[model samples]
Target: MRIALGERASGGSARDQVYLALREAIISAELEPGRRLSENELAELLGVSRTPVREALVRLRDERLVAIVPQLGTFVTLISTEGVADAAFVREALECAAIRLAAQRAGEDALAELQANLAAQDRAQAAGDAEAFDGLDEALHRSLCELSGHEIAWDLSRRANGHLDRVRRLSLPEPGYLGEMVAEHRQVVAAVAAGDPDRAEEALRHHLRMVLSGLGHIRAAHPDFFEEPAD
Candidate 1:
């Protein structure tokens, strides 16, 4: 709830802006799970009216990132393994399919863009800039999806990836994680450059699955962030 609207607060409609801000906060764990939300306070904090805050919460509820109780009020939903699995499935299905097409259709220029992104990722990793690497990581996948001539692949994956993203963000601090990620990225890009659709799919699939590999460790370390098992 202490999230600042900050500089990315412009451009989008009030509701869209609010939705993105709240979603990012929740995914980054800045807002934390199970925290009660006050529409009035959120409106005041984001310098918006309650109408937009209400609308944004509605969107978030649809994403299962928050729950609205009849009289008790809204609260950030605890992370659920089911939610994370659903996200992973959606992202893997879309991106894996897209990478196949990207490998088949990628021209030299398109491959160059991906190479440039990988180089940037390497630089970010070397500099110990996790934030920059995160953005670059997203850009690389987006560029690959775009290369498939299906921008919606990335769009849909992004919308479905909230829970998966939280796990990913938390895994950033694992020793050698950034370097391993960059190396995996290189393998994916190399396959695409070789115009080997099968190889590209294999590499991308492995990379995507690796993101889920640390989930157990993360959940163990931050039990408060996850939902309790149902009785």
Candidate 2:
């Protein structure tokens, strides 16, 4: 079901609103992989016109979250293991470098922000709010990139990280995973706060490795959700 964008008096552009809503739905898995997205249905459901829905779908396609097939329709892109693995590798390298740079340059305020984000994640996890926790996870990583003063790298990392997020969410249903993730974040925070670049990088790498391992289990559990590797 689509969430309503408030009253018509706001004068907000429908295309932008539709774009944001569809992006969130796809990222949160509300729109399942390979599910067909009908422009007419979406426009009707969202109280917008087909023009805005079409624009939103095109943007989603650019983001690789939706695919347009000739003579068929747009479908939510399937999560591919190879895609996840490649994205994970890129994220790990960028994030590890980010953490190390953060350790070298982050001040007390920046460190505190990171700590607070992790605390919020913990609260979200305890409340059984995986979606909220996921948002905070993105914030924390992005904050690390910002701390490095690398806006270009941060922007690139953000896109790559979106791809990795699909695999990351797959692990949330596993038993005891939340607690383990909390501990992992704590260790990374501590390392950054200690101003130990090497240690921070190590911690970041460890966290990425853990995420990759979790993705392995997800792959095993839902083979159909992923694309087969090219022969």
Candidate 3:
């Protein structure tokens, strides 16, 4: 399948566009684990020049999504349980603080935006549209961070989700996974809306821990995709 840039393509740098497109595909499992990548093939598939495709591949490799071999072409890296757990820790800590700050701010506009996000999530869950739900899940959390006056924390949190991205994508197909997440998100938002710091913190903590809660079943179901757990 071909990669296409979003609205940012019109004004953004070509290399950046290529990077974002390829990264999204990799993260969303569109490319899948262990898929081989060649700059020439990718350029052809994406219908772009080899230079930008090559540049994008370099960045993806740096992100640990693509591994370069001396003789072999680039391959998608397997998911690391360690990576996911570490990221979850960072995300939980940061988000707990964010929700506390958001509670303090409790601006009407931010609360409205969060409520709107919940409404969209409800529709996605009813439709069982995991991809849509995942996108909105990300947006809702980032919105809380931004509203809490900690946009940089959100950026930092996103960088830590490389392996977690795969787990989230893998879990999306499970029955009621996203729907369960919708309810957790609603709890977090409800706390934010009510301006309750303690409740917001607790809800955000629970929401973040949901990633850990499903690790057992996911690893059992997709052993090939996961790295062996450390002793």
lDDT of 2 at 4: 55
| TM-score ranking of the models | 1, 3, 2
Error of 3 at 219 (Å): 1.6
Top candidate by lDDT: 1
* Model 2 poorest 10 in a row by lDDT: 2-11
lDDT tens per residue, model 1, 104-138: 99998898888889999989999998878888998
User: Of 1 and 2, which scores higher on lDDT?
Assistant: 1
CA lDDT, every model vs. true structure: 0.90, 0.79, 0.83
Clashes of each: 0, 0, 0
lDDT (Cα, tens digit) per residue for candidate 2, span 1-231: 754553321356778788877776776577878889898888887888899889988887876778999999899988876767777788888888787888899898988898889889889889988767777877787888888888666677656655567777777767888788888888988988999999999988998788777776887886766677679
**Local error of candidate 3 at residue 9 (angstroms):** 7.2
Better of 1 and 3 by lDDT: 1
Writing each residue's lDDT as its tens digit, candidate 3 over 51-143 gives 998888888787688898988878988778887888898888887888799888978877888899999999998998887888898899889
Better of 1 and 3 by TM-score: 1
Error of 3 at 107 (Å): 1.1
